[model samples]
Target: MSEVAIIGAGYYGFKPITDEVSFREGTFLAAMRAYEQCNIDPRKDVDSFIACEEDFNVGIAISNEFAVDQLGGVLKPVSTVTSESLIGLASGYMLIKSGLCDIVVVEAHSKASNLVSPEKILEFAMDPVYERFLNFHPNYLASLEARNYMEKRGISNDDLALIIKKNKENGLLNPRASYSITVDLEAVKKSEKIFDPLSEYDIAQYTDAFVVVVLASKEKAEKLSNKPVWIEGLYWCSESSLTPLRGFSTNALELAAQKVYDRTNLNPKYIDFFEIDDRFSYRELMHIEALKVSNKDTIKKDLREGRFSKEGDRIVNASGGYLATGVPLDAGGLARVYEAFLQLRNEAGQMQLKNANRCLIASWRGIPTSTYAVCALSNGA
Candidate 1:
């Protein structure tokens, strides 16, 4: 199979609400920026299109129908992935490697503000017979995991606060980080608790965003882009959706990371930085342990000592991650990838890490589902 490289990318609508633009318009704006960046005519150059979204997310039964023309994919081989964005990227890569397309456009967005009760929608993803009867949102599950993880890993509320403090401060440097604000550990520690150990601010907020990325085969990439970020490997994994069956102490994210590492022959130490799941503060620590970057025993010290910061030995969530940037639903993985792409190419302006050449990104489908996708990228052809 041919290697796939991201040649052009664009992002738009990283806000709490985008009242002026509809979802389709948001996607179109991102698409336009991507086209302009790579100097490609979408209609003529894009051989296929993939839009990552869910029916409930767009508030329309058949959301992909409305997304077709706005993406300049009319009469083209356009399809939708109800899963997260990484899957869409994988699908696009498959299309190109199968000799079906040279250039594939992949898009994902979040119109989270439009949902009347986003929690209710998330609730619907649960098994109605067993889980939905609780009538509480999935945050309860997160709180359960947080409490369980803390007990097993010996992590504390203060440690989680440090993670929040560092990431939020990092967000201050990110233009797209809507939730980025000045915060201190004491302030986070004192915040009101949403669910026991989990606080009201511990959860990552939602934002409106549409991110589009252009992928081309190696041959096309070399001809089209002077700075193409190649996808070294990508894979996603999931535990059973049954919340009762899941072990709160461990998650599928670690399994996903191992698979990607095995596929790419790379690990945490080799990558310059990471953009792992941080929708919940504890999840960041959990994922780190699962990824084998560091364990819970020493991660707190590593985090406090700035090992994961920009000036630290290894950089993590340099884009402020989902905590600061606002989780963009299915777009979450691509959002991280977009940031990695910018950093690898030295285009991430204020948030750019000096001389970062390779990056790893992992995304988790929010609660009630243990699905996670891991991808490794490099500037090398």
Candidate 2:
């Protein structure tokens, strides 16, 4: 049984830069669309409002302070989550399950263009005494992990190139894929190498986007929308932040996946689609393993056999993923969730997958941090 259902979702700007609106304005636009679709006023119907973002990313302390007015949460309960937006989704679910709120709103976005060097903020998230003092590029963490996974999984340059080729090409079918292009495998392999084992094409760039979701109790959701994507299970986990304490793969993502699977009494074999994190090219494959859907031993076959493609058996990352859409900062996970929601509701136009009813989603908190969240969703069964 589902205690929470996503009744509405709204989004804006999947481009490298969104110069038109300030973060607050963009968020307001998205909230307006969401509230309109659900036919609810945030100030009246919403019991609480949650905003997901990091303080440093917004250049403001108490990230949600400036957002309450735009979200219509004036003089009402509003909280800010400094974690990934997917965790905010979990927070909303708990709010409903705990009988605290019937209707909750979640907002997350990114204005990467505002930061002269977003990587600097990532450094702050690292161990200040050890990793931060090294003063090396934060991406070194991704490169190290990629290199280790490559060696351990026997993944070659060609394998990573294939993922780039598939996702970028898939982006061509998605309207929000700002970075989407039809690059060939040879072109991907020829791209400049930024870090050993990780090339320019292998890293997903940042973009601006604000995503808002409206969650309600089961009965309320049915009344709000003809189709509501029910949250079957949701869980989040964190691993050690220290470099040495981390593993070659995202064990936290896997743990969260396992827990969600247990909670729902379901696994990958029973799901229809997936939208795991692909902020880094290899992270997608690594997450696949962690989700227990596929692994290093079997992924190469899955990729080559089109098992993860739109026509494939699994149909993963159908929204073009971060590889094509660019990273949407904290909203990255919610973006995936929203895409899956669209598919489940038959609202995903060209990118829609036929008969798609169930989706498994996982999101990692980008590089240097191991926080992860996974959720199981169905087309309101």
RMSD of each: 1.3, 1.3
Name the TM-score of candidate 1.
Answer: 0.97
Error of 2 at 15 (Å): 1.2
Error of 2 at 19 (Å): 0.8
**lDDT of residue 299 for candidate 1:** 79
Q: Against the correct fold, how does model 2 do in TM-score? A: 0.97
What is the per-residue lDDT of model 1 for residues 325-368, given as tens digits with 9 covering 90 to 100? 99999999888888998999999888878779999898888887
Q: Give stretches of model 1 more than 4 Å off.
A: 249-251
Residue 71, candidate 1: C-alpha displacement in angstroms = 0.4
lDDT of 2 by residue, 1-381 (tens): 347999999998888999999998999998998889889988789999999978899998877788788899999899988899999999999999988889999999999989998988888888877778779888988888889888887888888887887788888988789999988777777877787788979888999999999999987997888888899998999988787676665778888999999989998998998998888888888888889878768987887787888888887788889999999899998899889988999989888888888999898888888899999999954
Model 1 residue 129 distance off true place after TM-score fit, in angstroms: 1.1
Q: What's model 2's lDDT at 19?
A: 99
